[model samples]
Target: MKFAALMRSAALVTAVALIPATTATMAQVDGRAGPEFAKLFAVFQRVKASYVEPVEDDVLIRGAIDGMLAALDPHSAYLDGGDLQRLETMIDGNYSGLGLSVVMEDGAVKVVSPFRGSPADNAGIKAGDFITHLDGTLIYGGSLDDAVAQMRGPSGTSIRLTIFRPGRDEPLEVEVTRGVIELEPVTHELGAGNIGVITVNEFSADVGADVFSAWQDIRKEAAGRVNGLVLDLRNNPGGSLDESVALADLFLTEGRIVSQRGRARGETILYDAETHYRGDMAEGVPVIVLINAGSASASEIVAGALQDHRRALVMGERSFGKGSVQSLLPLGPDAALKLTTARYFTPSGKSVQEGGIKPDIAVPQISDPDFALRQKYQTRESDLRGHLINEIGIKDEEMESDSIADPRFQLTADELKDQGVEDFQLHYAMETLRRTTASTVALRPAKR
Candidate 1:
């Protein structure tokens, strides 16, 4: 037997032994039958007995598993053996492949964003480009799973992609070599006279520790006279629930950080900053947070917490709005299930679902003159509404309970242009920090 077949057989044997034959039989005899269970069993038996082509039991079972999970929500998914391995690498923030984040759109796999400095980005793969073919094989209308499998491979292996740009009539082909992509969580630099600028790419595991260590290093370099802080969360697709909470605790003194609400079985989890994990920095020190469309999930948690507590001024376009909590459930063996168990709420108890976190200062990105037309035609949430799965059944009370009453600051359009900052959001943050700190310092009593 082939290795794949043997693995599948072993998986089935293990699954059967764990379930107990009585459980399967009892499913049929139970008083309250699950709608999904009945439908799945009926489909399985029909496919096994009536399909013209030889139907493998394993394939049918896996399909059922996928369907059941997909029905729950877009984020909740069943990771097969291979998928589980890839997920493990992703959570570690390192993977060997053409680094790209993709989503299925209009029967084509579209590049949502390419990781900075990755093979795809280096090869000029821009966000909003549709990938139609992989190595001359038409990939459109196919499963995203198959496309991801084809795109990922060993380091140094070259793969050709046929891309469809928005304005171009002809398809463009680009060949890229895969490599191991290691993401840097935090990068810092001294900006504008002793002001500390820290850009966080993502909130992964150990990100809080990394940020704290970086802050310590920056303070030592500045000799304890740091003027301001700019926390950049632009393009930071977030990670780790605990990391977000911990990071917020570093700055906040007294406020609820975030809240999670789920089914009756799972109690709400709340993180507050009043406990004081990290000592206060400069008193009334000006801090600004930068966010954009790519800032999501845990990133939103940090931004929302700081903003709600009046700790920092937030600037940028609205965030990507992925306020949901997912639990990684091990399925034994190498497989696993990433299931969405709950939705996240800001300190004020707002649900950032379809409606994302709106920035206090909105600074939209001005596209380059060459790509202006393409930018005008780009897709937004309205275009992909069909794919969104609203499973949590949230109500207005839950969403509005934590809304921000008043914003501390706002930025004008000309101010953004004058900064000449592509991430004008970050620039606004830096400038806000500078102004606030100067004001605070001016108010301090002179040394006697």
Candidate 2:
């Protein structure tokens, strides 16, 4: 099994999948738990001996393991043959399938987001689209793992998808051919006014280095000093913790990046800036970070760190709140225990478990015609079954409450489309940077 921390927030249904953590040794149970173990064994024996159908020992054992983990939190799970294989494939960063990230919402397979250039994205399988069938077979109320297995196949293969979009009148039938999903973790572009836009798709391996290289390339392309930067992390479910700290370190000169606190001795860790990189790479350049309901885990770490330090002006909807860390304990060569071992906090000692990282500026995605409908169905960490509760109590009503409306955002989707504004959030961020004098948005030198 991969001996790394799997910090990606949302559950992935595509070939790109969740990561695993460090190996852990099984601890001895206390004598006080003997009665509970005895009862479990009794139930196991009764099911095996008296059931009409003979139940396999492994099946029962697996079920018990799954139930135990599920009771704790949604992120914890038992990973065996197929699950471990998927983890390996995700780590490898390439596979053949309709690239998508999905989660099981009340037994229905709901699309989180399609990988940027994958077959699903190309075929218009958007986030919030409920996939009810695969190849005309009803998949509602089915296992997410089974549905994912059905969706993936050899490259060049095609599968029919029955999608139920939230505001659509009827279910749409679409056929998409599977292709190789090789996700580029970091992608950059030079927009107007020498503004460099760096989009971190995921916190995969060496993503910090990639972003540094991207900045260099953007500077070269501009042939002059870059005025501002937009770090786009919208729809980005996270990855490695190390990568997140590294990415945040690029723009921060000093101070704590994030701190992990857990019950275990070694689980509590403090990550700070200047440990990975020497100093701020974009020292005096202004930065604006973009996030939405889809940005989570490692993504939140970067956003929270930068926001707390006033390194960037975070704009967009509330993020997908996921502050816990999952450590993969190797049970065997083919299996491991993906357990939530710690809850992480931002530099200001804020936990983004239930409430998530609130943006410095709340900019709605009014570019989608179904924005209201999509927002209604959009799921976050708090929406998941058995999610970790925040240490500081955060009410559900408060988290669900809409941000105050701004008259500046009164433009309709149709109007924006006619005006050639493909992405409203990006447009707003770019426009804000463009209009601002460079000094106002420039990074303040670190105190320490």
Candidate 3:
């Protein structure tokens, strides 16, 4: 399963323009009081004569504007002329960079996650890595934009990163060459028992078509033997909202998938799954959705919709709460504004803002003990208050479960332990799929 990283912008303020009537009033007041203009002229003359450092007046004005804007939320930001142009190119998905997603935490830059099949991922960069130095220069207390600028360069150029990872005794050094990171929207494989596993990394521009192609490939490979489908959404930070809706519509035949409510009272839009792509073989197949802490935004949209409609059973930790929709507003030249326009809601009218989607079966991931000894796992089925939607009167069904001493999903205990498969989550998912498929098939009618 591939994980997609969601890139977020640091907070700043939106620019406000003075109205014409207010400008006229200010001009009238200034003209009536010649003393105020005289005072300004005297101060300017005094500053010009007595200033110690040579400073440009335009620089001071721009600095003041920047300072004012930075006080707003971390998402709003101000971009200089060069940065504005680069942002324009980034929005078009064409840029040369290290292809890493970063965030500001504790006044330092932190790696949230690396894009799948990108330079950073290939370089062995992992999530929760703290970047202390970029190209041998200390990046602490620096602006995120400046750090990003240092990371981005011409294609085929190499950049060195000094990172600090948890559970490591010493910091590690990785040198990655910049490249044109083409976003891969979807990837799939046939799991054990011919179970179709589709990993939607992100909802990119061509994701809808890519998902369709992936489903076709899975169907062809299964040859009518596919008993279950596992939609892996782990660490998938969402992208385009429309693509998410379209992807959800692929499996669902008819029902309210998701809904969005803007700031206004009655401003709401409901999305439904209308088109049916799956035939008899595809319908009624047991679906197991995998998610984690990094899964957010559009990923949550699909997860919440499926869970609410009882279409798929979610398995993993809670998702990242990012249920808001942002609209890109062009500010002139190469500048733009990504404003939070509305809050999204699941089909049950539950808002996921600051509250994430909880799985039907809460499985705690095992990331410790060196894989030698047996590790205990916890499954939470109680009603958790922080869940996006409330689980009402739903009883946990008795499903058969299994475990492998080894880590590989397809390998048995002895084989996996020898091969050293470290992905405990995938192993657990595979077992869950087997158990669910058996239970589903056992309940079905026996053919004559």
C-alpha lDDT score of every prediction, in listed order: 0.68, 0.83, 0.63
Model 2: runs farther than 4 Å from truth? Answer: 1-27, 167-169, 399-403, 443-448
- Distance (Å) between predicted and true CA of 137, model 3? 0.9
Predicted candidate 2 versus true structure: per-residue lDDT over 139-226, tens digit per residue: 9997888998999999999999999998778999999999998878889999989999999987777889999999999999998689
Q: lDDT, candidate 2, residue 309?
A: 87
Better of 1 and 2 by TM-score: 2
Off by over 4 Å in 1: 1-30, 34-39, 93-95, 103-107, 143-145, 153-157, 165-171, 281-283, 367-423, 432-448
- Structural similarity to truth (TM-score) of each candidate: 0.77, 0.92, 0.70
**1 against 3, candidate with superior lDDT:** 1
- Which ten-residue region of model 1 has the weakest summed lDDT? 11-20
After superposition, the stretches of candidate 3 with alpha carbons farther than 4 Å from their true spots are: 1-72, 78-97, 105-107, 153-157, 166-170, 177-180, 264-267, 275-281, 367-420, 438-448
Local distance difference test, candidate 1: 0.68
**Model 1: per-residue Cα lDDT over 328-408, one tens digit each:** 544545555666667779887787765567777665554233244554555433234433433555543453354453343
Candidate 1 vs candidate 3: the TM-score winner is 1
For 1-448, candidate 3 gives per-residue lDDT tens digits of 0011112211111111111123443346645668866875686667767889876786655555554444533334445464554433443556788777676655678776687878998888876678989989999888777888899889999999998876666889999999997656589998878888889876665666777788779888989677778888876767777777877776666677778766644336688777554422346677778887677778888888777767777887677666666554444334444555567888777766555687786655554332212121211212222222222323323121333332332344455556564555666676777776544422232221
RMSD of each: 7.9, 3.4, 9.7
